[model samples]
Target: MTSAAKPEADQTVSGQLRRALHPGGWSLRGRLLGQLVALVAVACVVMGVVTEVGLRTFLLDKLNGQLAGSIQRVDSPIGGDQGQLPLGPPTSGRLRFLGGGAGTAIVVIDNGTVTDAYTINQQNYGKPVKLPPDALAAMETVQVGKRPSTVDLGGSLGAHQVIAVASDRTPGRVLIVGLSVVDINSTLLSTGLIMLGVALIAVLLTALAGELIIRYTLTPLRRVAATASRVAELPLERGEVALSVRVADRDTNPRTEVGQVGSALNRMLGHIANALAVRHASEMRVRKFVADASHELRTPLAAIRGYAELTRRSGDKVPPDIARAMDRVESESIRMTALVEDLLLLARLDAGRPLRRQPVDLTQLAVDSVSDAHVAGPDHKWRITVPDIPVIVPGDEPRLRQVLANLLANARTHTPTGTTVEVAIAQLDTGEVRISVTDDGPGIPPSLLPEVFERFARGDSSRSRAAGSTGLGLSIVAAVVTAHRGNVTVTSRPGHTEFAVHIPSED
Candidate 1:
């Protein structure tokens, strides 16, 4: 790959990733599952927080009560002069001081210096246990008569429920006693993590269950959609539209919302089928009338021209005014005959009349058609370019020639007298013959281009009506090309307009 393309490829992949992860872009099923899981997650998180706060408060309150009872063991008036702890079975009471577990610690300070310290089993006193700095700072901020509070102490001491009070054993001294809350914090953390794990499991289950339930609920709606889809693929725009498709009996029960949709769809399809039938009948009648009238008018039109010519040839004395009138009558009759013949040809093509499938040289047809266009509009420029090789295609010879003539004549008539018209015939790599007529004239109006090939479609107001176009030329080109199992299209802009026909080439 080139260096320029690498960044573009990366950007495309990144864009795809962003779209997949975006919540708003998710499908209906994904969104439903996500919302359900989110609700479950929020509920779990709120429950976990409330439970943690309540448990911590209860444990702290219990620790404070233990510190209060331990204070009674001190004796007053032993004074700062002595550092001995008051002796007693002081351990006894509703207090259980005798069994003060390893988590308990108590200390006494005189003049801001530790004079005595003890712990359950009396651990670490010989090494001189000291009160943590945070607890000491918290004691300085305590107001008189406020409830005892908790402080976080350093290292092994962890967090504590501590109280600052006067030493009963020594005057001008202080007591800081606390029980370790490491066990309480440890318990809360473990339980919190377990609760978090359970919350995750609940969310996962909610997502799975939501997806299953939504799929089951929408199953009937999907069946109804499939029924409509099959009907949409039918060729309803042409000929007979047999719309017999309907939703299943179970889907059309009408008790559920999906069932209501299915029932309504079936009714709509039925109405459309009736409308198409009526349209087909109307079109058949119109085709029959045009065909019959054109066939019957041909003989009269020929006789009118023949008698007018015979009168001009007769040696008898005819008045000058009568000869001129006969000329006018013959001219009008010839024009009317051409119109009738065009209508008959269109009606037959619409009726799907078969044409002879002979191999015809498309290049020769372009040459002959351009030659005729030159004679018809000698003032207009005419040109043709054919490939050295024969551009052979299959169709009726006469009909294909008519297709080329119509296209060339359309270009010559719509363009100004001095405009240039060119006809081209080429065989495409895909083994189709491409015949195009291009003109360097004022293009068709943008608004009219879409319907330019419709029957009797006329050009802009500025177009000269003196050319006597029956407006069936391009329409015939389109119809005959279509009947030969081909396609026709046109494109136009200022100073350029082109009509191209593609027909399958024979081997």
Candidate 2:
């Protein structure tokens, strides 16, 4: 079945190709253009034919009228019974060739007997009354009248003129005066050939001009693409590009699309320059942060190692004061471990590692975190407000729990023993679960609000009151919410401070 279907598909495609290649169904632009030109040429030829035929008909009508005048001039015969008519002075050989004339021939028919009158071409002189079939056909149908009639002979000699008039001087019922139009046809043919040749040349020239127009019109777009490709190839890590790195804007013609592209490219280059400068500043800040973090960790680790060595060497001889110092060292070492772990978690989050996500109830998470904060610092009044209805949000449950716990813990460490710490979870109208931890503590100064989410940024750096967890609690909150495609906002005032986490609902 598959093999049969494949052949059927191939046949269908081949049939389409055949249709596309048909005389009236060209598929390519070039082929279509050629077809259009051919149609125009054919139209020109048809128009020329119509024009030539009309002109010939008009001329023949006039010529027959002139021939009728010639017949009237032949009034009386010079001799009797011979049917020889008197030739006028400007008679037999008197007819002059009209302007660019070739020659002429004449034949006369009388009383059912034909007589040759004159012929410029000798082979046709004095021949039998062999009229063109068209002329003869016209004669058979025409009545004997003074007015001449014209009949197209349908060759080089387009039409022959014939007139029948009363001739009392001749022993004949009618006088058939006819003429051949060989010279007139030859002139018409030559003129038509010249016109067709000129028309073909003009069409060719027009097509060439059109091609150049299409090329020049599209040049600017090509330049813009090339410049963009070269710019894309540049290393963004390089701190700054010299002014020499600019692309060619001179070739851009502003009156056209190319010109607009040039203008846009210049603007793009400006944006790229600004972006690179910002990136460099960010890299410097990161380097400084790393240096500061290493220095801070080294001191604590060295202190712990030194104390451990002293304790091991002294054994029972070490004084109570030295033993207490060793205990302090162990406690500090544990704090350092916790700080390192927090830093590592923050680093992973910054690097965009996927966090564990599930449907977590923010209200319940807030309660649990507040309870933990109250136990951690029994002196602080930790208050939590959870909605009656469970407000469910998509997030990592532990991380959401940790986020509230860290904020409450910060409140405990910063404020005095009896400061009220409030955690609230409420659903906002914009399909988000809003969780805010507000503390009646000394608020963040206006100057530090912008950089509050930066790594290791802290409002109060006092040794005794500094918040634990590597000073990245707010930063982790920001990163986690950002990963969930949500937002974290902070508003702090002297007697009121709030950090809100707006996690989007799963629905």
Best by TM-score: 1
Q: Give the candidate number with the greatest lDDT.
A: 1
lDDT of 2: 0.65
Per-residue lDDT over 1-507 for candidate 2, one digit per residue giving the tens place of the 0 to 100 score: 001234343357778898766766653345646755677678777877887898787777767766665554443343433434333333442222221112233434566654434333325443322445554545444446656665564544455565666455566645445555554576678878887887788678756765566556556667777888888888775444442344575745567666777877777788878777787768656745754685578676777767676675666677789777877777667677566656656655655578777888777777778888888889988888888999988778877777777778778876778889898888888888788888888877677677778767776666533434456777877777787778888888777878887878863
lDDT (tens digit, per residue) of candidate 1 on 417-489: 8999989888789878889889999988777788888888887543544566767888898889988889999
What's the lDDT of the predicted structure labeled candidate 1?
0.77
| Alpha-carbon TM-score of each model against the true structure | 0.79, 0.44
Assess the local accuracy of residue 113 in candidate 1 as a C-alpha lDDT between 0 and 100.
69
Model 1 stretches astray by more than 4 angstroms? 1-24, 61-97, 105-128, 140-145, 154-156, 163-177, 208-220, 296-325, 417-420
**TM-score for candidate 1:** 0.79
Which residue runs of candidate 2 sit more than 4 Å off their true CA positions? 1-317, 463-470
